[model samples]
Target: MKKSLNELKELAKICRGDIIKMTTVAKSGHPGGSMSSIDMYLSVFNLANIDPKNPYDYKRDRVVISHGHTSPGVYSALSRLGFLNPDEVIAGFRHSGSIFEGHITRGIPGIEWTTGNLGQGLSAGVGMALASKITGNNYHVFVLHSDGEAPKGQIAEARRTAKKENLNNLTVLVDYNDIQISGRARDVLYVDLFKEYESAGWNIIEVDGHDFEQLFNAIEEAKNYKLGPTVIIAKTIIGKGVSFMENRHEYHGAPLNDVEADKALKELGVENDIEKYKEMRKTLPLLRKKLEFDDYVITADAGTPITYTKEDKVDNRGAFGNAIADLAKINKGKIVAVDCDLKPSVKLGKFEKVSPETYVQIGIQEHNAATIAGAMSVCGVIPFFADFGVFGLDETFNQQRLNDINHTNLKTAVTHCGIDIGEDGKTHHEINYIGIVRSFFDTKLIVPADPNQTDRAVRYAASTLGNVVIAMGRSKIPVILDENGNPYFGETYEFEYGKMDILRKGEKLTILTHGSVAYKAVKVADKLKKEGINISVINVSAPLEFDASRISEYIDNSHIIIYEDHNKYNGLMVEFSKSVVENRLSPLSVENLGIDNYSPSGNNENLFKIFGLDEDSLYEKIKEKINK
Candidate 1:
């Protein structure tokens, strides 16, 4: 139910006081921007289809605040609207033990997405809007952002996407306060907010942000809009309501002093309850419980895992594409494919063909694509973002990091990893994927050893929850085989995450590898076997995680070598060293051969040979080490 105009005005005034007290009590936060956006926040949550009683209603319209620095304003608005206790937020605003964090978090009763990185909220909003399209839901997505963060290229990219997808159910409210952390937003960087979004074909509306009636009317119009997405350029004053703090950039991030707070309280006619909150703040603990994210259970048929024979010359990327297409067929409404214009290169062509409606082609916007896929993953649909490794991982690491924090169930199949995309040179090579994924606490990295493994891994990620990055190479290699020459990673084989697969066991030495080099490790093992030398070849597919107990047996009391088309210092070597030290496993000798430096343009075979990662190089190195 919409609050009466008179009630909203009274609440807005109180909310202004709430914002000031919360930030001042916290003694650190973006108070000026919070005051500027308080009225907008009040109007939206009050008028939108949200029930504080049933806050987790999946049908409730999502409210995403992009400029998370103004978290004080958001908490104030939410509390005043009865979603939370207004006094608790006022006292515990930035206190570490409080749910009211320094930045706006998602698990809060009314908040939808956690956003502080300027340009990502709109993309997330777009993702939620796209969710409505596929699921036959009519709920709208409202993204409240700041004009200071308007110049971000990702917003422009998302703007184009909103128009391209014809998302009429989306509305963006840009808090156009001229002042920013530097000075005026224009002086820092001129982003013609209306023109940029208008150029992208979004319907534009200019409004006095503090006016509840106008804000409500524009939002209502936006909801009823059928042409495309709408953007409300809300003209607001920095540090609004309080007379002294108006239009000042100094308070953009700072709270008011005691003297200033006293004077401000007098001007607003609101009680200065600082002493009461101070007592409460003193008693609060420093550590808060971890925030819980929305549970997103993805249900999908993994289709059937395919087994590539020794005669089948196929790249892991091709196998991934086939699996995605197959999953699309079996899981009709439950799956979506997010692509970044590298459909052919990333081998998403087959998936696109099989499920055109489920395939979302966001052109050349990796950051936006990452966030979009992350948001969509949580909102009923399982989104697979298929892209090249350089663009997917190296280019958009921060976006993926946010996805990790959001605990999104995103399956990112990144092809063209390592020097395997050899002719493209060092720029295209994603040698540090293991290092990148290692930084994440939740995301899993599976460097599938061959097409057969890739097929099963892709299906595994699709059926599972949480973030998964299936890293693959560009080159087509032969399928791996067992001692009897039967196909390894066969149809009967299930892709058990964190469990290492031992294909050929030997006692002379142990070779650890994954992705494109597992088959090469077998070649090295086979070569030594021909010379009557025994060794073990193990496939460590899930680099970020592995069954340490299983790997302890292979590396214990034996010479070990780690061969890969990855960075030597940060890849499996790091994980192996950690596990070995922790488990007290003893290795007679340890050798790691990987890309120490970027290789020049050449074929993958030549690049491998140049870097001493080729089968012959590994065979020779192991032979010398065993003799020693």
Candidate 2:
């Protein structure tokens, strides 16, 4: 039976009460947007074909809360729907150890995508809808936005793409509360969302966000129409239920004190009903279980195991493509791989050969490729995007950052990193890829030293959690470890994040490098041994958050020379220099050798020599610097 308008209003009131109590207890949260969007959230979740019990159900509709600052509202709805206990949900809001973080996280089961940053959810939702259409799945994607977030260009980009593609299964709900943190949204930035979205070819609907009946009717109407995507602009007050706080900008992110919580609960008619709420919390797990069983009926089994012979020598990018192709053999429909017109370059040709239906050639559109990957990740299909490091990081840095913000489990394989791309000239050489990617806190940058590590890293990244960027070099080096011959022992090489590997130990100077430069440093160290200079070489693959203790131990014993195939300003050299100074390790003279300025077009060897990165140049520079 469909819930009545009054009942939905009552649920929204209950949700607002919970939002106040939870944020107050946590002592921090966005209450204004939470209260304002409570009715819209209640209306959508109540009517959507989502199985709270089976949060991971394949066929269930997906909801992505783009305006993640309003996590209080999302948490409230999840709590009422039986996905979380009221107390646990309340306790975890902004708490250190709790999964109920300040923003929505993957730790919460029913939350489709973790989000905090605005303007990212719409792109992710578009990807999900696209994946469902491509895979022949009957699932709809719903994304909630803030009127204040309209200023971000990605949102407009996503809207245009959805319209062009005619993604009718996608629905976007804008919480037009007309207020940002500072003041009125109009004062901050005036955006006519209705006209903008309509002009972009979206079917637009405007309604009172607090009116549950009107919201439900619009959603139903959108579901019935199948021509293009729909945007439901929900006009609402900043803080709805709490009279003292309603429509106030100050309450946007302020936490209520004890007296305020009491007053808010009193207004909601649930002042002394803690016990009743606890009882309601106890029924949620069961409700979720029932919902899961009903909605997530279609199960895609793990497909056949892939067998590869050890005779073939494949590039890491090629190996990644091959592995994905193998995964497609089993679960063909559920997996989709997108490339930015660099399929042949990234070796996605293997996957394209086997499962052409699952491979999307986005045609050199790096931004579109990233947005598509974000969308595909949310739809439950593991999407791996491949492109050159310069294009992936330098070109689409914002898109990837948004992917991280949305917490989409998107796997990005960036190849042709560093000067190893060699003959392609300085334009194709990308040495600062690691530093740029490492800047994002939520992203994991995996630089595989060899093909075996690359294969393992790619496989693990595909199966693992959260957003990951796997970097691969252009040069084909030796296989450091044999995974096929000794799979168990090979796994022990241990890919613990932020850890460095000691390649060679010497007493004179520490040569810290990563990617292709590390291999060059190893060769240089071997040659320098003949000249009686024992230099230690460390392959610092995990550059973002390196194990300081391990690095300090190496630095304590020897003078440091950090070599990278990137610029010296913000690359590995700068980070190493900063780490040494910050940790106050043993006083050691540090010299950085890398591309000093903008590189000019030249052959790889000539460029390396010109940049003082060649083995001979490095040997002479180190010998001269060390002797002094």
TM-score of 2: 0.74
- Candidate 1 TM-score to native: 0.98
* Predicted model with the maximum lDDT: 1
Which pairs of residues clash in candidate 1, taking residues 3 or more apart in a chain or in different chains? 498-547, 506-535
Over 354-413, each residue of candidate 1 has an lDDT whose tens digit, in order, gives 989989999899999999999998888999998989889989998999999888889998
Query: What lDDT tens digits, residue by residue, belong to model 2 across residues 1-628?
Result: 3467787777787888888877777678999999998887887787777766666777778888889889999989878876677777765566654567788875466676667867777877878788888767778889899999998877887887788678899999999999999999999999999889988999999999988879999999988778999999999999887799988999999988877878888987875444444343444432121112121212233233233334445566665666677767767666678877787888888888888877876665577678778768766577878889888887888788777765667788889887667677667777777678866878888876666556666666666677788888776564432213432214356456677777767776888887666667877777787887777888777677665466676788567887887777777765675676688777367788887776766666777898889989988878886787
- Give the C-alpha miss distance for residue 568 in model 1, angstroms: 0.6
Indicate the worst ten consecutive residues by lDDT in candidate 1: 291-300
Which regions of candidate 1 are displaced past 4 Å?
293-296
Cα RMSD for candidate 1? 1.2
TM-score of every prediction relative to native? 0.98, 0.74
